[model samples]
Target chain A: MEWRAAVRVTLKPGVLDPQGKAVQGALHAQGFRTVSEVRVGKYIQLALTAESRREAEEAVERMCRALLANPVLEQFAIRVWPAEQGEEETP
Target chain B: MEWRAAVRVTLKPGVLDPQGKAVQGALHAQGFRTVSEVRVGKYIQLALTAESRREAEEAVERMCRALLANPVLEQFAIRVWPAEQGEEETP
Candidate 1:
């Protein structure tokens, strides 16, 4: 089954994302005032075909382990979607 | 309307993700030998109610600009989904 995988990797909240905080300050400088928060993170879009949901999760976990994420300071969430649905669905 | 948002930011390739590379090496050292890539990042699950899809995106973009990402080194994408769809849709 060809699926869409969204892999999010972010720094642990208490770890101090100065980069994120700095960007937050910059946005305030830019005048986009409605911004309530600014925490920087990574999103990986993968193109894969799996036989089952389990297989896809395992594949994404593998990708995270190899090229998609770091486990020590960051955490991730994996959602597998069937290729048929567009942005209208949520996991 | 309540919706879901996914944010992704990655270090520019070749910018030296030593942290990510180190974790990749560690995964290799472990027994999960099939992992092909592991890069490390953040996932923020937001529960927001918006008037429209555009509003939701603007909200997340605001979040990214201020606290979620560093414009100097990162980028992001926003997708909005209705609360009715479960985890089976693709964006």
Candidate 2:
């Protein structure tokens, strides 16, 4: 079966995030005064073939640990679902 | 009311994504051969004050238009909800 996984990698608590601070400043300058803070991170989408949903989740978790996220400074969350028909699959 | 917004900004179809391609190659090299493709994008979280949910949605949409996304090459999706208690709020 074909599966789609969405991985969100975010900075752990107390980690300094200069990019997020910069974005907050920009928003405030643009008159978005109510915006108190901003945090920036990565969203990764993966397409792969797996035998079942359980198998897919396991693979995605392994991938996240191995390459998608830094265990010390970042945390990752994963969501997986069966791929839908008509979704683009690049060759 | 306090609100939190999650913004996902992704490349539109057919926009060249070299980063995605590189990650895909790296995954294959690591021997997880079932991986077919990958797409990388930005995930941004915002903590803000709004009068109501409707107001928060409108503000987030405007933010997307003004800076969060490049409409020519990317598309953005926004999810907003009330801030949960105990969530980190940087002073």
Candidate 3:
């Protein structure tokens, strides 16, 4: 079966996020005074072939640990679903 | 009232994604043979002061258009909810 997964990788709490701080400054300069804080993270979408959803999820978890995320400074979350006809296409 | 918003920014379907291709190559080289495709995007979390959820959503939409996302090359989605006691803190 073909599966699609979405991974969200965020910095662990207490880690310094200079990119987030820079974005926050840019927002403030644009006159968005209501914005109090900003943090930036990564969103990754993957398409894979697996026997079942459980297997797909487990593979993605390993992928996260091996390369997708930095265990010491980042945490990740994953969501999986069966791929639709056109959803798996690279274009 | 304080609100928290999450924004996901992705490249438009036809946009070139060298980053995604590089990651996919890295994954395949790492022996994750089942993987077929990968796309990378951005996730942004914001803490802001707003009178209501609707207001917060609107403000975030505006933020995405004005700064967070490039309209010509990317698309974005937003979700907003009331801020929890500790969620609004910058640290």
Candidate 4:
């Protein structure tokens, strides 16, 4: 089966996120007064073949641990679904 | 009311993503043969106060257009929900 996964890689809390802070400052300058906080991270989308949903999950987990995310500075979360469902290809 | 929004900012299709390519090359070097392709983008989490869900949606959309994403090279998608759901705070 073909599977698609969306992985969100975020800085572990207490880690200084200068990029996020810069973005927050930009928003505030633009008059987004209601926005209290902004944290930025990486979003990765993968398309691959898998035997089943469980297999896909395991593959994504391995990918996250090995390459997709930095375990020391970042943590990742994965969402997996059938590729044919058509959600992965969107911009 | 408080609302949380998650924004995904991705390169428009056909845009060259050198960072994604680097990550993909690293993954292939790691022997993850099943992984066919990888695309990387920005993920942003926002915590803010809003009068209602509709208001929060509008605010997030405006933020996306004005600062959260680069409209020329990127597109953004926003997912909004009540702040108390507690799903937004995970690592």
DockQ for each numbered candidate: 0.17, 0.47, 0.47, 0.60
Compared with the true structure, what per-residue lDDT tens digits does model 1 show for residues B32-74? 4444445444544444567888998887777777766667776
TM-score of each prediction: 0.53, 0.92, 0.92, 0.92
Name the runs in model 2 displaced over 4 angstroms: A85-91, B85-91
In candidate 2 chain B, what residue range of length 10 has the lowest lDDT sum?
A: B82-91
Candidate 1 — what's its lDDT? 0.60
**Weakest 10 consecutive residues of candidate 4 chain B by summed lDDT:** B82-91
Worst 10 residues of 3 chain A by lDDT: A82-91
Candidate 3 Cα misplacement greater than 4 A, ranges: A85-91, B85-91
Which predicted model would earn the best DockQ? 4
lDDT of 4 by residue, B1-51 (tens): 989888989998899988888888888899888888788999998899999
List the RMSD of every prediction in angstroms. 6.6, 4.4, 4.2, 2.2
Interface RMSD of every predicted model, in angstroms: 5.6, 6.6, 6.0, 3.1
Q: Worst 10-residue stretch by lDDT in candidate 3 chain B?
A: B82-91
lDDT score at residue A75, model 3, on the 0-100 scale: 86
Error of 3 at B27 (Å): 0.3
Instruction: Kindly give the stretch of ten consecutive residues in candidate 1 chain B with the minimal lDDT sum.
Output: B82-91
lDDT per residue as tens, model 3, A1-91: 9999988888888998999999999999999999988989998989999999999999999999999999999988888888884542321
Residue A2 in model 4: lDDT = 91
Which is better, 1 or 4, measured by lDDT? 4
- Judged by lDDT relative to the true structure, which candidate is superior, 1 or 3? 3
lDDT of 3 by residue, B29-88 (tens): 999999998999998988999898898999999999999999999988887878884542
